[model samples]
Target: MLIEHLTMEEFAAGLERTRTVLVPFGSTEEHGSHLPLDTDTMQAIDVGRALARQRPIFIAPPVHYGVCRSTFDHPGTLSISTETLKALTIDIVAALYRQGLRYFILLSGHAGGTHMATLTDAGEVLLQRYPELRIAVVSEYQLAAESGRELIETAGDSHAGEIETSRIMHARPELVKGTAPAEYPAFPKGLLVRDKRRFWPGGVWGDPGKASAEKGARIEALVVRELRTLVEQLEAWQDS
Candidate 1:
């Protein structure tokens, strides 16, 4: 069930049955020229809803705008500062912890550096503060890596690549463009450059030509399976 959709009394009643909550984290950024700006958010929500169906977990409203410093060069990309994202995550989880929800599963769809690091750090602090709290940060791609590589045609690039585009196709097909050009920028030949200006001139990192709804469905299925297993394990831990 979604916490945002429930009334105060209803939410409280549901919490009495299950302390586990799933929080979907994503970013609003340019997903190449094919996928929609909300592709990450849509995928996260779809996975969260699927996980909720298999277990009695409350689905918190998604943090749609996250830290995407790498993609800030792209137009229409809305990224928060790293510090802001960290503070927001800490505060939100702390609030839920006070409400007796000790188990938190953070579902991150965006793979940007700052967002992933902030999530891991904040989750670690929360777990340390509340020993009983089982806080886990799950990257859907990591969970579906093997399947994604085998199923997706373009698997190497990180941003707006086949995996992401396919996932978006499955989650929101209408938002995907039919004829979008794909480009794979050559890796830097010289020493690594720290400046965004030197690298990633087009605000994208991967080739999106091989994206398909079939691959997306396969990836989504794998993620759902892995997440369900984790949720079952958490339930067993709670019982023990």
Candidate 2:
């Protein structure tokens, strides 16, 4: 269930049963000219909600803004520094740990380098600080792979590509501009490309023209299935 909608009493009662909280992290950046700026947030929320239905989990409100330096060249893309992102994550995790929540599963929807790197570092620190707490970072692509690779056309190139575009089309069809001319920008070779210094110019790395609602539904199904497996694994570990 969504943590923000619960009353204090309700949340307290929930803590008695389980201390795990799932955080959906996303970015408010350009998802090409076709998809909405909130595409990452929306997809993350959708997956989080689906997972909550089959398990006793609390879904935190999405972190809608994240590091998107590569997309900063595009208008309307909001990005934060790596330091800021790292600090914010540590603070949030520490607060949750104080609140008696021991498990924090971060479901990140952004592919930005700085954001992911900061989260990885923060997760490591939080784990060391609170050994009793369990933390897991769920990558949508990884989850999808566990189910099946056929769900995605181009495995590595996911941004605004067939998989992501289809996902947005399935989750938020109205927000997708189906008429936009699709293009797949190439990445330069031999560069230590971080999120801030990407090779692509237009923020689009794959061809989004193949995106369709049908494909999107398939992708969503795979994500949900894999998430169910992850939750079950967590439950088993807790029981053990």
Candidate 3:
């Protein structure tokens, strides 16, 4: 069940069954010419909802901003610093723990390196404060990447590429403007440039042409299955 829609009594009842909660984290960064800015957020919460249907779990409201890099120069891309993200994450976990939630799944749809690091770091802090609490920081991509490896044709399909395009197509079709041409950035190794958009103008990392709604549906199902496993693992954790 979605925490926002649940009454306080309903939430307390859910807690009695399962103390675990999934908090989706996504970014307000530019996806490409086609996908919506909230692409990551939409995919994340969708997975959370699907998982909830399979089990009695509560899903917290999604955190819609993240530490966006590489695409910072792209239009409509908004970012937060690592410090801010860490602070927000820790605060959220602290609040939830006080509410009797003991298990946390910080599910981020944005797979940026900096963003994921901040989340894991926050999980560490939460653990230090409450050693008995169970927390897992993850991105759906990390759980389901190999599952889609065969389905995707792009060599390094990431960002607003074939896999993402297909997933978005399946999740929110009307929001997709149109398919973007296949493109990749040419950033110099170990050198960060000021005009990042110059290196990656189209903002597409793989061939979106290979994307199809059929493939997207399969991918979403795969993600949900993997996430279910993760939830089970978290609940079964035992401090030795």
Candidate 4:
């Protein structure tokens, strides 16, 4: 159920029966020319809602800002430091844990390297403080990358490419407009610090034109199925 819609008593009752909480985490970043800035957030909430339909869980409001330093140069990309993200995440977990929620599934839709690292580190700190709590943070795209590789024909599914575009098409078709032209800009082989704008000039890494609502539906189903397995794994740890 959506936590925001629940009254305090209802929420407490939900917590009493349901040990797991699903937190949709996303980013406000430029998603090429076709998709909207809230693409990640929309996709994340979709996943959370789908998962909640299959299991009894509290769906927390989505986290919209994330670590996007690489893409910050692109207009409309909102970013926060890794440390800030870590602290915010830890605080959120602590607050929820106080409500008797023992399991947290941070369903991230963003793929920033620092973002993922910060989430993992925050979960670690939460576990240290509350040894009884169990947390799992992961991205739906990463989970589908292994099995849905064939579905992606764009340069790559890293950014607002085929997979992401398709996901949006399936979730919210009216939001999509003309797509950015496909370009495969490569970065320096040995560069330690690279600029996303230089490597991906179009702000698009893959061919979004290749995306279709049919493919998007397929991808969404695949991600949800994989996430269900992950949630089950987390649930298994609740009583241990």
Candidate topping TM-score: 3
Superposition error at 173 for model 1 (Å) = 1.3
Return whichever of 1 and 3 wins on TM-score: 3
Model 4 ranges with Cα > 4 A deviation: 190-196, 238-240
User: Which parts of model 2 have CA positions greater than 4 angstroms off?
Assistant: 145-148, 191-201, 235-240
Model number with the top lDDT:
3
Error of 4 at 121 (Å): 0.8
In candidate 3, list every pair of residues with a backbone clash: none
Model 4 lDDT tens row, 1-240: 899899998997887679899888899999888889988888889988998898888899889999986788788998988988888898888888898888899888887888888899998888789988988989877975765777877646577888888888888999998677775657777675556687766777677878888998888888888888888898787544
State each model's CA lDDT, in order. Answer: 0.78, 0.77, 0.90, 0.84
What lDDT is reached at residue 105 by model 4? 93
- Kindly list the per-residue Cα lDDT of model 3 for residues 218-239, writing each as its tens digit: 9889889989988999999997
Q: Is candidate 1 or candidate 2 better by lDDT?
A: 1
Tell me the TM-score of each prediction against the true structure.
0.89, 0.89, 0.98, 0.94
lDDT, residue 165, candidate 1: 77
lDDT-sorted candidate list, best first:
3, 4, 1, 2
lDDT, candidate 1, 65-97, per-residue tens = 888776676778898988888888889898888
Whichever of 2 and 4 has more TM-score, that candidate is 4
